[model samples]
Target: MTLTLTVSDDVRALAPGFTHVAIEAHGLVNGPSNEAGSALLDDAARRLAARLDGRAPHEDPHEDPHMAAWRQVYTAFGSKPSRTRNSAEALAKRALSDAGLPRINLLVDLYNAVSVAHLIPVGGEDIDRIDGGMRLIRATGREDFVTVSGGEETVEHPDAGEVVWCDDAGVTCRRWNWRQGPRTRLTEKTTSGVFLLESLAPMPVAEVTAAAAELAGLLADFSPGADIAVRAPESSA
Candidate 1:
């Protein structure tokens, strides 16, 4: 692995437009960092959810409870927010200042905070047993874009050119805004979690690393009681 990263051999098969990211870390929770982050998300969640009320639907084919609010906003915008940078930022501004849910936890809220504030989809899965090495590529209908779990809700046309984060398991995650990853998700009974700050474009390795540090720092400052580890994609020899 290069620079502490352990990349899978599937990199060679990735589509030309996709960039891969992977991170692994461990840390202690309940400190100042965890507390502040939790609060920030709490506050943001309340405001965001309120704004998304009546607008965010429970079933958008790309259903995610944590992202129901933001997804509602995306649906309002027709689900095509230009795929450019700052899309998250626009959504966050609308969500926090406008109005909806006052009942989400801090972890989920903070994820929304970063996602909307930065215009990137941030999502995670339960810390379950993930089967194999993951790869990021395009879904040539071979791997269609399924939004909600149980293969129920899926997008009819997922911007065909858009890159998707998939594993051998399936269309397990994505980058447009709300991400889904087997290892990086945080859920109930979760004491440890990992966060990935994916790039809008092929960011320099330095910048990507820097974003990871800042995100971890933000968590430490806000959610002062949760353990968070931030890292970069695994490097190869």
Candidate 2:
């Protein structure tokens, strides 16, 4: 059950500084949050909230340089940044204001905490659910994107040449890291999965590597005996 992941030439040509860290873990115990993990998430939320203390997310200071690069990716895909913000930006904005981050599952909460703390967009997908391999590439506009909207399952398509994460099935994520498809989302049954940490410059490859290591450490502490493999920067299928 090996998962192949890649970043396409089009994406690399668009953003030369782009880099991703992938983590493949198995034997995870997915359940409600545990005491230690919950505590870590809480502490991270508070610290991130303090960092954004009274400023709205739309302001210049609220913008993360890494996320800003993603905005450019969205623009290249014919999406407006004001309308569809990258996931990291939206989460940081929520933490900055009264919205606040809510606990989902253990895996989601852990990645969300890291996303806010480091201002990087992190994506987690259930490896078992993914069909074939995954690639970061420009879309062809006919690919299916299965997602849930208003409690209903629906299918959407990306614009031609839009940046997306896809598999043999269809689009896994549209507009880069904006939203994840419902088919491959992480759930309680997800014991093994792949997590990606995306970064752009001035963030540096070293920082992204450090962030991936931190996530691997947290996963180790929470899922004790889980087998985890960390794939470093520039690794692809």
Candidate 3:
């Protein structure tokens, strides 16, 4: 059972520097990097570039007004950037201090390690094998997004145009490339992971790319590997 990851062209267009950097780094290692589990992430800098491909992103979240706008939406929608306060994320952070070695369901470990490894936000779902749906598009100004734990929900659309990734069901994830769906989420029993990689303001382009790649690499490293890829925005023109 090989693992597979995929990304949208929108994301690919963002981080030319990081992608180039990763490719070079892989080449420098003078070895093989299996494609199955490798992941990719991109945001502000990469998206606004002219070439639309490289190792370094063009903009940082803090400096990108578009990103800042999304942050506001993330907050309005009841989701927080990975930098926000959350007991679950905090606990996961503490656990990583001694994450030791990766030896769980290949997909699970792949992204979980990503969570701890880059300290950026990476999310996935059991789409290929799970019994639910996911969505990441913007609300129709009348969407009814029911969260994992029943509670009030709010959302803000991005100025660069909201990049939504949804399943056959509802809006699982929101924003162009932030947050994730709680429904299509992964579990200990997960064997195949379909994920969405993300990075937010204050985090470096290098870090996000590395985190994304780590997941992709881990998937490739597994006996039963995974699918790794990147996704970007649809352009604001």
- Measured with C-alpha atoms, the lDDT of residue 20 in candidate 3 is 16
The lDDT ranking, best first, is 2, 1, 3
Q: Which ten residues in a row have the lowest lDDT in candidate 1?
A: 57-66
TM-score-better candidate, 1 vs 3: 1
TM-score of each: 0.51, 0.91, 0.44
lDDT of 1 by residue, 1-237 (tens): 111222233322331222324333233232222455546654654544554553353312122232333343334423443343223444454454434223244555555565543334445433332334444444454654445556565543344444455555555554344345333345544544445454423334464465456556655654465445554343322
lDDT, candidates in the order shown: 0.43, 0.82, 0.41
> For residues 77-114, what per-residue lDDT tens digits would candidate 3 score against the true structure?
45564564222133233432343233334354455555
Rank candidates by TM-score, best first.
2, 1, 3
In terms of lDDT, the poorest run of 10 residues in model 3 is: 21-30
TM-score of 2: 0.91
**Highest-TM-score candidate:** 2
- Give me the displacement of residue 2 in model 3, in angstroms: 15
Stretches of candidate 2 off by over 4 Å are: 49-62, 235-237
**How far off is residue 207 in model 1, in Å?**
5.5
Residue 45, model 2: lDDT of 62
After best superposition, candidate 3 residue 138: deviation in angstroms? 3.3
